[model samples]
Target: MKQVKINRLSDETSAQLQLLTIKDMMSLLCISRPKVYELMQNEGLPFMRMGRSLRFYAASVQRWLIEHEQVRG
Candidate 1:
């Protein structure tokens, strides 16, 4: 008998593994379309260029947001 290992992902991990489109980013960040492009260019928002289309990973975007968050004293 052979034993195989199974890899499992938590619910939160699975949710964070999604690829977000421009419209998805706009809705998620509540920003305009142009703003999304500006962030990708100037703000160093993590993304991948697939042909002519841009794709953002949910986890990377969340991480970027957290890194850029400003705290008011």
Candidate 2:
């Protein structure tokens, strides 16, 4: 798994930190690489294009998760 050193901080502080790679997203979101790419297409997922590489803002991704969260009980 890729290394994603997220700060175990308050919500206010969480948004001030790093970006994540596709591999990192795989681990963080507990999803597959294909799923991440799907979200990038079908969903308005934020990303940064660095040459041929794709990067995502960690904070934005967390917020995306929060907004897309579903609960099943």
Q: How good is model 1 by TM-score?
A: 0.78
Number of the top candidate by TM-score? 1
Model 2 residue 7 distance off true place after TM-score fit, in angstroms: 20
Question: Candidate 1 local accuracy as lDDT?
Answer: 0.94
TM-score of each: 0.78, 0.72
- CA lDDT, every model vs. true structure: 0.94, 0.86
Could you tell me the lDDT of residue 46 within candidate 2? 80
Q: Once superposed on the true structure, which residue ranges of model 1 sit more than 4 Å away at CA?
A: 1-10
Q: List the residue pairs that clash in candidate 1.
A: none
Which 10 consecutive positions of candidate 1 have the poorest summed lDDT?
9-18
Report the lDDT tens digits of candidate 2 across residue range 1-73: 8998976787767664677899999998899999999999998788889899999988888788889889999
Per-residue lDDT of model 1, residues 5-58, tens digit only: 999998898988889999999999999999999999999999998899989999
